[model samples]
Target: MKELIEVLVERKQKNASPLPYHGWVGPCTQVSLLYDGFRLGDASNYDSVKSFAQLMWPDGHPRFCKSMHTMATQIEELNKLIWLMIIDSYGLGEKWESVMINYKMLVQFMKYMAPPPGVYERGLFAHTDKPVSTIICDDQVLGLEVEVKDGQWIKLSLSPSSFCFVVGDPLRAWSNGRLKAVNHRIMMSGDNGRYSIAAFVIPIEGTIIKAPKELIDEQHPQLYKDFDFMEFFLFAFSDPAKHIDSGEQLHAFASLSPPISN
Candidate 1:
């Protein structure tokens, strides 16, 4: 992982194009992976054709490419299992099985070093993972923080082998507000540097993301209108102004119908 971080930093130093993040946070480098677990899936063909690893790592980095492929593949598998469990918990297991869940995984490597004394801390601003979910694997340093009730930011303590999960917009809408898509931020400490690889789990672009019929009853009214995953994804990256904070864009899709009478 350290070697991968070195490559990312070195490439960024060379002015490689950073992922356009709608001006939300500072610069970072990422490589999107292929394979939606189906041959000719066409779910990630556009990205896979680009070969992000080859583009970023370039020559003399066979190990880097190999590692990226291995990690992305493993994470994709994990993504499916986790999604299955999540939907099943909401009693949508049988319905979910009939629909294929697609995801585009990215190997994001960020390097955060302590800023000079007395300067305003420079780190990623508070935001939510816009996809289905994010599986974060951080090195020793703990710079990640989650927003709890009352808007308090809580620091995380992660072990070397532990991975943290952050829920995302799609699931929150799909679950009719039953699930929580946490608001989180990164704060680099004055004495340590941090690096992490996060797999941003996205869903099938064409899938309509609305609360399942079975999950929505008189007691559990639909909170959000039906929306396509790709549309929401594009909206998020298209304009930071629209979504300046967590739940802003999502709230835009709120359903206004009166609750169903029991």
Candidate 2:
């Protein structure tokens, strides 16, 4: 991880950009490595498999390109295992294999350096993960915070080696209101830098996301409408700076609900 951080800092120093949203060389400079999903229509989509470093510094491989790719793959596999376990624990039965068959995933290696004092107070804004689940390695940072339903903020003190598993917007929708996507943010500590890796496990585009029949009943009526994953994907990225209220925003696609009695 230290090596990867060094590589990113070097790249930023050499090829930094003024655009705040560019993932590789801007304000929130992070590298995202995508894995199998609908976007890669076929195995022959060679261009899609190129490393991030290769994309930015196409002339040659960055120092830790291989290491970063290897680390991303490892995290991707781990995410798959954790996803399977969550499904099994819910007793989704034979529905498991067919449910999220088209899901896509990517690992984000983020470097949120300590900004010059008073320049930037927050690193990442408050937002929910769009993936089904997110696993984070905070790297002993003390800046991660979660906002519960009551609007109270809870600070997470992570151990260097500990992992934080977070439920994302997709899972909340998939579980039919049984789960809530956590709203989280990253604040600048103003002392030292922070390096954290996050794996976002998302569903494939065009896949219909909704609650399973088993989880929907008279008492537990469907809380959300079934919608295309691709549509949701577009909505999610429509505004990179927008902070979404997961449930409220998703309600835009809500199916007709039972009318209240007069």
lDDT for every model? 0.62, 0.61
Indicate which candidate wins on lDDT: 1
Q: Which digits, one per residue and each the tens of the lDDT, describe model 2 over residues 1-262?
A: 4543445444545433232222443353231111101111111123333434453454545444555556556667777777777678778756787664465555556767776656536777677776667778867867789997788988899766778889877677787777777888887755777777776665655678877777777777777777876576567656632454544556544443761111
Over all chains combined, what TM-score does candidate 2 have? 0.75
Q: Tens digits of per-residue lDDT for model 1 on 100-204?
A: 355566445556656556543546667777877878887878778998999898899987687887789887877778888898877765675667667776564
| Alpha-carbon runs more than 4 Å astray in model 2 | 1-25, 28-50, 116-120, 239-247, 259-262
lDDT of residue 210 for candidate 1: 64
The regions of model 1 sitting more than 4 angstroms off are 1-50, 117-122, 238-244, 254-262
| Clash pairs (backbone) in predicted model 1 | none
Clashes of each: 0, 1
